[model samples]
Target: MSLLTALEDGVAVLTLNRPEVHNAFDDALIAALTRAYESAIADPAVRAILLAANGASFCSGGDLNWMRRMAGYSHDENLADAEKLGRLMQIIDTAPKPTLARVHGSAFAGAIGLIACSDIAVAVPEAEFAVTEVRIGLIPAVISPYLVRAMGVRQARRYFLTAERFSAEAARTLGLIHEVVPAADLDTAIARHLKALKAASPAALKATKALVAAVDQPLSEAVIADTARRIADQRASADGREGLSAFLEKRKPNWGQA
Candidate 1:
């Protein structure tokens, strides 16, 4: 269980278990995470996915050896390797279920991508974050989409250029972390968020997320019409109808029930 995954009461916990290496991403780590995410997305019992890492720190970003291997490759080969990491980020970003990143310690470089991809993130107050790519003469390009979107252009400008390490409190101020808790109570804190997520309808949650992201995309008649149709279809679905009914009936929605 190097990449531990468990679906309990509608929450899929995806724990990065390679504490021995600071949970850095080598080929094995990427493959394990991709598999766990795919499983979480496919499991109907899972309403949300939580990403976490064990050990004193969270992910240390790319493994140094992994970088050294990439450093020897041609530009095309390097891009290919980067794409693999990008794909993992995309899978987490567009996961049909909601995602949360629970960071207990430092999250650096590509590790920030993980937090950025999560729909919600809660980090321990002592956790640190940095975009350390520039410190090693590399650009933080691959993670630009999630990073820029998470921190916005202004904040990305500061971090990407300076490569400065910042605290979790600073990340929250920049709108990255939804909340912060002491390490002593991180589990309790994450559980509180998951409890709220559990109360939501899975399909409705997915539909709502889609709506939120798409509703403001460059407005065109086709975009508006397509989105309207998409929402209308979901509103009439089995889960959708049940969700509305459950609210009126004052009962939990049928999630995790066969």
Candidate 2:
């Protein structure tokens, strides 16, 4: 299997299993990932997700073998192929559940997109990152939106043009990754994040994600009205009421008890 999945204690871990290729993506892997994500999203038991890999490198972007096949495709064929990748990124980015990336070694090209789509990313101090599409005479077109959002336009301009490799610390400083820790502490860091995520009401977490995405858009009068309506709706929700009641009673929320 190119992808591995496990659900435990409300956390679903999706592990890239193609270590021989440094977890490089191909059509099969892409399809598998889409399915895995869909399954996790549909399963109410899953409260959080961890995107991880089994290899020296997290993901090397595209598989060389797959690229060779794409080289022979016509323009239309390539466009269709690119669309599949875009859809995969969209699925990860729009997932309602809290998503985290367990990044180690190196994450390049499309792999960077996966990290960017994640709500939080944790990397080891020795990890490396790059937007390397330019070196092969190709552009990082598909992943550009999420990459720019995560790193900002200014940083994207420099790295996208240079395709230069950078350290994990540089990635964190640029806002692409949330935390950098020693290799030995990677799991500990991820666990901490999972613990925090699991403590929140699942419904509220989903609404919160949507809230942020909506706020990031141009704030027109209609958008402002919609935001106000959403908060009001949440305030009347069962989970919301229980949360407030729990706080006043000096007890843990129902969601946290699980």
Candidate 3:
């Protein structure tokens, strides 16, 4: 299997299994990831989602053979392939549960999109990043929106055009990742985030994610009203009441304690 999935302690971990290829993804791997995300989103037991890879490098982007095959494909065929990749990115970006990426070694080309789509990302200090599609006569089209959202248009412009590699610290400066820890502490950092997520109400987390998305648009009277309604809805929820009561009572809510 190109992807390994496990549900443990309310976290659904999706591991890229092709270490030999630096976890580079092809059509099949893309399909596998899309299915994994869909399943995790629908599974009630899954409170969080983690994307990790078993490899020297987190991901080196598209598999070389996959690109070679695309060279022989007609325009329509290429479009279909690109669409599948796009869908995978969309699924991760829009997941209701909190999503995290554990990045290491290198995240290049499309791999950067996976990180961008994730709600949070943590990388080792030695990890590298690049948007090198332009170097190979291609544009980072499908992943452009997520990349731009993660690093803003100004930084994306420079990297997309220059195809220059940047350090993990640089990626954090651009807001592509939240933390740059030592390789030995990578799992520790992931555990801390998972612990924090476990302490929150699952439904509230989902609602909060939706709230963020809703407010991303231009603020209007409608948008403001929508925000008001969202908070009101959550306030009326069972978890909301429990959370408040627990806070007043100086005890943990029904959810796990951090």
Candidate 4:
């Protein structure tokens, strides 16, 4: 299988295992990833997710044959297929649990969407990236939401228009990679983040993530009031009180207690 899912110690790791093709996505890979993400969401035991790939490259984006297949499909079929990819990206984007993209190498086209949807990304400095769609005569409409969100309209305009290759450093500068580490130390860097995540409360992490999604970058008064309401609710909740008490008393809150 090109995709594999495993859960251990409250962390779910989904590996894109198609090294022969740099984990380029096909319909099957898309379906497998969707199922794996859904399973992680359904399983309360899963507190975090790590997206990594086997091979010298993280992902090559759309498979050529798959693109050919889509090129020949009807418009309606293409729309439906696009929806699947969009849904998978959205699921990962809103997964409640934290998501980390472990990119050791290049990520292009649709493949980059996965990274953009993640909460944190740790990539090797040498890892390359590109929009890689205009070169093939297709617009990156499907991946636009995540890609634009990650790189913003200004950066997106340059890359999406040029479809030019850029280094991982450029990606990091554009707010894509959270940290760009040496290739040999990529996994170690990601592990450090995972370790810190593991020490935090899963429920608190989930709620915090939800809050971020719900109220990031908005300066509207309504949003401010709504955020305050949420904070007040958390302050009075069992988890909230326990977390506060633990901090003040210098003790760890029992996992189930909050």
Candidate 5:
């Protein structure tokens, strides 16, 4: 299988298994990833989704063979192919459960979209990132929305146009990832985040994810009203009441029990 899916202690782990090619995006891998992500998101037992790869490089972007095949594709064929990749990115971006990327080595071209779509991304200090579509006489069209959202329009414009490789530190500075840890401590970092996430009420986490997306737009009367309604709805939820009672009673809340 090009992708491996496993559920471990509430985290749905999706591992890119194509180490030989640095887990490049072939059509099969793309389809497998899309299905895995969809499955993870829809599984009620899954509290978080983790994207990882077993290789020296995370993902080097489009597979050469796939690109070669695409070279001879008609306009409609290419459009369909791009849509599949775009849908995969969209699923990760809008997952109700928390989504994280565990990155190492190099992440180029389309791989950047996977990282950008994640709610939290942790990369090794040696990890590298690039938007290299322009270098190949193509644009980073499908992943543009997520990339722009993650890194901001200014940084996106520069990287998209220049297609320059950037270090993990630079990626963090640009908001492409949340943290840069040494390779040796990558798993530890992931565990720490998972632990924190597990402590939160699942319903609250989902609601909060939705809240962030809702408020990411320009503030307005509708935005303010939506925020007020969300808070009110949360307060009235069973988990919300339990959370408050647990806090007052000096005990941990039963997160997913409600």
Candidate 6:
């Protein structure tokens, strides 16, 4: 299996199993990831997702063999291939459940997109990152939207063009990663985040993720009115009513009890 999945305590841990290639993605791996994500989203028991890998490197981007095969393909064939990868990124980015990237070692080229698409990313201090496609005569086109949103266009422009390896500290400053900890503490850090996620109402968490994506778009009158309606709807929801009543009664919310 290119990917390993386990569900425990409301968290679905998706582990990249191809240590031989530093967990680099190929067509098979991409397909496996898409299925894993869909399965997790469809599982009611899963409250959060932890994306991890089994080797020293988090992910080194595209598999070398996959690239070699792409080199001889016609333009249309290549476009089709790229679309599959883009679809995988889109599914994870817009997933209703909270997603976290547990990054270590190096995350390069397309791998950076996975981290950027996640709601939160935690990396070891010694981890390295790069947008290295430019160095190899290709562009990070598919991952551009998520990268730009995570790192801002100014920073994305420099890294995407330069293809230089950056430290985790720099990545944190650029908003690519949320926290940088020692390697030994990576699992603990992820656990902390998962605990917090599990405590929140699942419906509210999904709504919040949607809200962020919506707010990022141009704020027109329609957008404003839509947001107002969403909040009003939430306030009148069963979970919302229970949350308010629980607070007033000095008791844990029903969702938290689970």
TM-score for each of the candidates: 0.81, 0.84, 0.84, 0.82, 0.83, 0.83
lDDT of 3 by residue, 42-158 (tens): 999999999999979999998867765665555456656776787787788889999999999989988999999999899999999999765544567777777887788999999
- Top lDDT model: 3
| Predicted candidate 2 versus true structure: per-residue lDDT over 1-258, tens digit per residue | 899999989999999999998999998899999899989999999999899999898998888677666655555556667767777887888899999999998799999999998999999999999998655545677677788888899999999999999999999999989999999899999999999999999999999999998888722434333433443343344554455455445676674221
lDDT of 4 by residue, 12-92 (tens): 999999999889999899999999999998898888899999988999897756765654455456656766776787788
Backbone-clash count (model 3): 0
> Candidate 5 residues 64-158, lDDT tens each?
77766665555556656766776787788878899999999999988998999999999999999999864444567677777887888988999
- Regions of candidate 1 where Cα sits further than 4 Å from its true position: 216-258
Model 6, residue 140: distance off in Å is 0.4
Candidate 1 per-residue C-alpha lDDT over 229-258 given as tens digits, one digit per residue, 9 for 90 to 100: 433343344554454455445677674232
| lDDT, candidate 6, 3-35, per-residue tens | 999998888999998999899999899999999
How far residue 54's Cα lies from its native spot in candidate 1, in Å, is: 0.7
lDDT of 3: 0.83
Go through the candidates in order and give each one's C-alpha lDDT. 0.76, 0.82, 0.83, 0.79, 0.82, 0.81
Clashing pairs in 4: none
Candidate 4 runs further than 4 Å off: 217-258
Point out the worst 10-residue segment of candidate 3 by lDDT.
218-227
lDDT of 4 at 60: 86
Clashing residue pairs, backbone N/CA/C < 3 A, model 1? none
Instruction: List the lowest-lDDT window of 10 residues for candidate 6.
Output: 218-227
| Candidate 5 lDDT score relative to the true structure | 0.82
